[model samples]
Target: MKYFTVALLAARGAASPPPPLPAAVALNSRKCRRSWWCRRRALGGAAGGGRMALLYRATRLKDRADTHVFTFVVTRSATREPDRDVTSKDFCCSHQRWAVAFSRTDASLGVYLVWRGACEGMRVYVDFTFTLLSRDHFTANEGFSGKQVRFSAGCAAQGRGRCITLAELTAKFADARGEFQLELTMSKVRTLYSCELRAPRLDTPPIAFAGFDWSVSASGGNKEPLTLRLVRLSGEGQRCRVRYALALGEGERRLHSGPLECVCDPEGRTPPWNPRPPSRILHKGVRLTVELVWARALAELAVSAAGRAATCYDRDKQAWALRCDTHSETVRLHMLYRDVHNVPRNHLRYVSWSAWLVRASPAPGEADADELPGAPFEHYYAQESADEGLMMETALRVEDISRAGCAFLHAGGELRVRLEWGDTYLLFQATYHVYDDLCRLHAHQMRREITALQAENYSLERQLFSYQKSLAYAQAQAGEPVGAEGTGRRSPAERSLSTDTEYA
Candidate 1:
């Protein structure tokens, strides 16, 4: 009897559910203002309501040594307590920089851009200006020593990673007169900018490699030298083609390579090929590898993955992380590797900025620990974070997709590079600094070797995949199997690899 009565009541409840979402309710109206905050409060909600994710807390030690500009921005992160001191620990890899923010009391929406180094040495003068006509949209440009950089912005509503580079950053709208009405915290996204300059350390080399490589890529601390190197190009003076890569910790990785052609070959006019650059350069502990390969057209590339994690490589399949461009004669690759660390907790000791060299005066609008004036732990000086770092700001304009995670300017070590083109040697001067990660960042042409090797590796991996796939397809049509285990396959390398990774 009781069950029958309960069933009757349940049927009555279903007959009358909540009224249809006000068919055509006016937005920004008080009639439904109470529910507005309730609806969009979690994901990038309006001001005061905007969140500074746990991983992106402010550097709250209180500035004294120098008046460094500080901003509040939050990069998307998985961690919540980012402000906890992470002394001597590795920096977070998921996001290398801080997502800057501006408070409601703030009057401007720009980087505080604090300069910090031991003893206050380098002079920093920023003259670039940007206009935020509306949310997720900005436009600006700057010229540094004849080099022009671009700026761009895009709405995340379209989707994540849909970025607009420097040119596109400022090209979207021309009517952005002044600033748009932004809810101090909500509309103020974690913004970054890049400017062209004469300093080498301030900018990344045209090519680079990131993450862990058997052949460690060099780091660029402080200001880098004007020239870079291609390690040992002992191609026997042969017109050889190879590749390289660039990494910027957490952003994008770029792989670029060209014919390191020795016009006057000592051995012969045409050589077989240069010892292939390493495949390690093509990876950063991740699965994506930017490969620049020169086929009949240009280089080609692709992100690699299979069994377990995305980057797990399979020697048996001859599968590696990398891609290639179709229009170039050379290939360079950077395997998006597993990022280790780099987070806000890494910067807790910076109480004051030395005159200029040692520390930075916390500037408002500046958010990333790498951008602020802080010492790299006690031994190294980790400058240039994903959100901060003057040189990092410069690279932003170039849209250098590579080395977005691995490139940075230090403040303590001497940044330098050595290059050799058949004994025609050249040396470049680079200011240096120790990174919080304890890895050495090279400041010279040494950057080329790693980048080049990664590119070559990606190219080789691609060829191997194409070859195997085609052969397998052809065999299948011919009623043949693939691989051992009655699969029927060839290639000693593939069989040797112990993992079950797929080239696809």
Candidate 2:
């Protein structure tokens, strides 16, 4: 039986020699011959003696593919040198050139699949497997697999850096010609929907992808941290995952966020990304690359109005006034921007503004305010020359504001405003307070003024204390009395000045 196992191992092209039979199998030879089950067990023991090379081959064969097979060989001379890379000849797959690369660093073997096609700012999604084939080509000694791995200009290769050790490859996987063989099987190779924009406009025209039109927009000026957003222009009830990579300014300093991942909802919009470390300023002509990695259909989402109505404070009417058509049902909110600069007769100033309306707690007895059919929105006005005398006005809308639990009359509402001009950025926030009449408004203003005066008075008191300490220190150093007659008491004129300072 041991000789038969050796013969089988030799026929299967196993590199290792067969082992001796176990004592139990040797002693039970008569019983093994008497029963079919015993005979089968003896044969299994024989196969195990040969290291089960047939089973190994079967398992490796299950993973091997006939198509997109790229073979790379590491020559003996190359394996002797550490830090040597032996790459295979280019082969075409998915209409692009791909090759297998084998590298040796110290004593470790690294395997990678290299992309040699024209980059053109594209990202490829590929499913691949790498197998270190044995000398006989019937079994794999080591393997690595990757699923949905991304390959782009920045990342042109994907695989395992430590697929196998050099000593193990030399001992087990090297062929009779004294070379290590590696096989790569690639499948499901496809290009993702990618787009690049240079010096993007406020709203770029829609580009079609996967039966949907998508557009990108840029906000924030050259001095501000740039914000980029993706908006679906045509498709409805669709969802997708996107990856965005940004390079700011002419130097192309990549954002540390790397490939920012965003999930776009059925509304076809992704949350705006303001790459952090606010010190990274976005210049006017930056580059942005976006790729749609995955997408799927979603259930229908509720339709809402997309129109914006302009509103401003009317000086003559003493109330908020909408400047655009009010008949639109979507006109549920208004934003007013008061210009800080006064304009001369024919002069104009460029000031960019952005505002957000954050809803507060629901009104009394209203529990479903958050569920009321309204979408959060932001108002943005670009930097264009405008008369400084005119109040900068923009508006946003929310659906079903008149519904129960959706009234804006309650307190706790917050209006956040951002103003940018040249290299300056200013942020102002105001909390909503309800006033029933003009008298209450006037009282509120007076109370605010009193609070400001109190703050000023406290600051003045601190300054006076500091000044008194310095004067006393100087007098003491000069051997003079800090106060009148060294009694630590101020004279009548000093007392009067202190009293006046306290009141002021």
- TM-score of every candidate relative to the true structure: 0.17, 0.28
**Model 1 bad stretches (over 4 Å):** 1-106, 112-209, 212-504
lDDT of 2 at 236: 57
lDDT by residue for model 2 (11-35), tens: 4553332222122321113242224
The collision pairs in model 2 are none
lDDT of each: 0.23, 0.45
In model 1, the Cα lDDT at residue 364 comes to: 71
Model 1 agreement with the true structure over 1-504: per-residue lDDT tens digits: 232243345334332221111222222232342242234223222222223211211122333321112222222111111221111111111111113222111111111111111011111122221122222222122111101111122111110111122233234311132111211111111112222222222322232111111111232333321122233223332222223322222343422223333222343122222212322211222222122111010111122111121232211111222221212222111222121122122322121111111112335765222321232111112222322111101111122223233222122221111111110001111122121111121222336555777777656866876787788888889988676437466464464343663332
- Residue 109, model 2, lDDT: 61
> In angstroms, what RMSD does candidate 2 have relative to the true structure?
29.4
Candidate whose TM-score is highest: 2
Provide C-alpha RMSD values for all models, in order: 28.3, 29.4
lDDT of 1: 0.23
